[model samples]
Target: MKLLCLSNGHGEDVIAVQIIKALYQQTDQIEVVALPIVGEGIAYQKSRIPIIAPVKKMPSGGFVYMEARELWRDLQGGLVGLTLAQLKAVQRWGKQGGMILAVGDIVPLLFAWLSQTNYVFVGTAKSEYYLQDEVGWLPQTSFLQRKLGSVYLPWERCLMKNRRCLGVFPRDSLTTHQLQQFGVRAHDFGNPMMDGLFPEVPIVEEREEARSLRILLLPGSRSPEAERNWELILEAVESIIAREKKRRLCFLSAIAPSLDLNPFCERLQAQGWQQNTTNSLSTPVQDKQGLEFQKGVTRLLLTQTAYHSCLLSADLAVAMAGTATEQFVGLGKPVITFPGEGPQYTPAFAEAQTRLLGASVILVKKPSQAATVLHELFSDPDRLQLIADNGKRRMGEAGASSQIAEYLVNQI
Candidate 1:
């Protein structure tokens, strides 16, 4: 059987890669091709997956909804033409009896449904938590939501309920149950995001590592936007150090390989951070993740090759991201998030994230306020424990990819 994987955004690409990897583990008879609606599908290519269509990196970077001007800019960047070409590609694949595995929001899901072939959806965007938790609607539920019943929205639910949709795997079971209420073929198969977070060698925290407070920094994976977010992050770091000068703080900057390190390093240097080469900052496991830098009692490590190590090494996170923040919370760690000037991490997005993640995320107005939130966060251990429990429940468990793969191999 032939299969086409359609996804949007870097996060969706990564999730699709996880499922594809699991698919290979389940069976070898199927041929797979990927169509990353956003970016160049770097994650797919890294895993040796074939690209079956032309993909473009738009000016909005797939966050056109953040600002109205971003959508206009994408149109000027040939967004319409690129979309038409992609639609043709999908139609051709459908004519060949190729099934689709859509991982993301409406864009990919709509495309998959339009393909006229059997398709499955891994709903990574909207969740029932956005409108209501396991109980009822949130306090801030909009007028539209009170009537809609589900965060899947009316038209989105319609697509999922279609007979052509072979399966629907939501990020969490609560969402699956809600979609099932609408007669959709939704499954409570955990989430693929939690998988592949374990490195070959886990970073062990002992001795000095246990003494210092560790923070994982996730600015994001997008290009220019990530570079821009770094400024606010550095300021937040300074704010954090200024308030708690006595504590030994370890900051792990989990840089994506796609981003240029020179820009980040230059910013650190300008901010009076001295590059450190000595092994004195022992990580207890593998020789610290990446290059280390120092300023006063605080140590910052920028790592590109050790993504999982960076996530595992931190006790908390200062996040301005989507999937990365969710992944951090999935580790049962609380995140202090601040809005950024973005095509991605805007105030609107951050607010929605708070609703989606529940108590796992602490949203602040500005970067400078991060330190204040951290202070309060550390003050209450009981609240911290509750946040941890809420996070693991929100992000769901790992191995969803394996389960989905097994189902597809046997059923689809």
Candidate 2:
């Protein structure tokens, strides 16, 4: 049996690879290949999955939907030609007969549908939480939303209901229930994004006598955008230091392995932050790649290797990321987010994320506003617990990849 997995964007690729990797464990009878529609599909490459189609990194970085300007830029960058070529490749592969696993949103899903092959969709983009959380509908709705209601939209539901699309796995239970109500074969096996997010080392609690507040910073995984986010996050860190000067604060910047640390270090150096070689200010951590920077009493550790440990150990987070932020919230840690100019983490995207994650994500208008928000959050233990509970409910528990992979093997 042959399987062609289609995914778009960095987050989607991660989710796709997790399931495909699990699929490998479930059966050796299947021959799996991939087609990443956005970026370089580094996640697939890292997973050792073969690329069955040509992929180009577009100017929009697969987030053309964020703004018309991004869409125009991608068009100028030959988005149409690249997409046509990819579609042709999918068709060529589909002609030989196989199953398609479409991850991300409509782009890959539409590609799988166009292939005229049986396919399953793991809807990573939209979730029912975008429209309404577990409690009720959010405020300030557009008339279109009031009428349409569902986040999957009408045409998307139609695609899921089609005979060729055998299974639909949405991000959350609410999304699955919504799709099923529309007669779509949606399943709520939990989100694969929540899988394999364990810490590299067991995060021990601080002794009560020497306890300090720990914060995590996620500046996204993408390049120059992450650099810019680092600057913005630094501004917030400065504010946090200013506001809480008396208290001991440890900030962990979970730098993505793909990002170069020098540029980020330069930004801090410009802001009067000096590298703390002694690691005197930081709490015990397992990352050898971690570099500690000090600006007075505030200690920031920029680590490429301790990404999961940082998330698990954090008391809270100041984030401007997609999958990383979601994963942090999945650990029942509250996230404070602000907008950035982007093809990705734009103001619109941040607003939507707050809706998707509900109370788990506290969206502020500016980076400086984070200090006040964190101050407020620390004071309200009940609210903090509520946010934690909401995060667990929204993101769901892990182990979804194996379940979905097993389902695929049985069906195939």
Candidate 3:
């Protein structure tokens, strides 16, 4: 048997990787192919899975609907051509009489349905939490619309209930229940986004001088904007250290593999942070690889290895990222975010994330206010625990990928 996997965004690609890996463990006889819609399938390629569909990096960074300028830029970037080629590939693969796992929103679901193959839909994008009880208010949808569904539109729901779809997997239990209410066969074993994250605990020595607060900085994965976010986060960190002189603050910047660290290093140097190679050695907790920087009473460690370790070690995170933030919150770590002007990580995205993850991720409107927010959060342990518990409940536990793989294999 052959299985084809289709994913839309970077986060979807990562989830696809986990599910694909689980599928591999289920059977060696089956062949798997991945098709990434947004960015290049780097994660798939790294896993030695063959990527059959044509891929492109859009000017919008896969967020075309967020802004009209991005849509226009992507159109000029051969979006139509790339999409047609991908559809043709899916059609040809489906003709081989194998199963397709569509892992994204409506687009992949529709594509797989159109392919005339038995498909499993993994709805990673849409969740009822975005519309119903996220921000203590209802979205401006009609009563009929709410009765049908909030996140999944009527047309999407119709397709999801199609006979060709063998199973439907939703990211959360609420979405699963909503689909079930609509008479669709949906299940939630846990969020696949929370899978495969193992964090190593670090050994600590008693220090009588001052207590340390560890903060992980996630500046995101997109270029130029990611660099810009790093600068902004550094500015906030400087403010944090300046204001709280009593406690020793340690910052760990989790650099995405796709990002260049040169610009980030230059920004830190400009902010008067000096590299301290001999003073602090890289430990296993630091992924045994990282560059250490020191400024006043604060220390910064920059690492491009083991993102899970960074998330595990962080008491709190200052993030301008997307999937990484959700994963951090899934681990019950609270995060602080600042909205930026961009093709991604905009105010709308921040607000959506705030609603999606609940109070686990706090959105600070201004960058300058981030320091104050972090300080306030740190001072209130009860509030921190509340947000952390909310995050745990929102993201759910891991092991969804294995459950999905088992179901798919057994069904086939």
List model 3 lDDT by residue over 255-285, tens digit each: 9888878998888998898887684553324
Compared with the true structure, what per-residue lDDT tens digits does model 1 show for residues 206-240? 67644778888899988898999999999899999
lDDT of 1: 0.88
In order, what lDDT does every prediction score?
0.88, 0.87, 0.84
Name the 10 consecutive residues with the lowest summed lDDT in model 3. 279-288
TM for candidate 3 is 0.94
Task: Point out where model 2 deviates above 4 Å.
Answer: 201-205, 278-281
lDDT at 311, model 1: 85
* Leading candidate by lDDT: 1
Model 2: per-residue lDDT, tens digit, 291-330? Answer: 8888876778888888888888889999999989998998
Better of 2 and 3 by lDDT: 2
Q: Look at candidate 1 and tell me the lDDT of residue 251.
A: 88
Question: Candidate 1: minimum summed lDDT over ten consecutive residues — where?
Answer: 280-289
Ranking by lDDT: 1, 2, 3
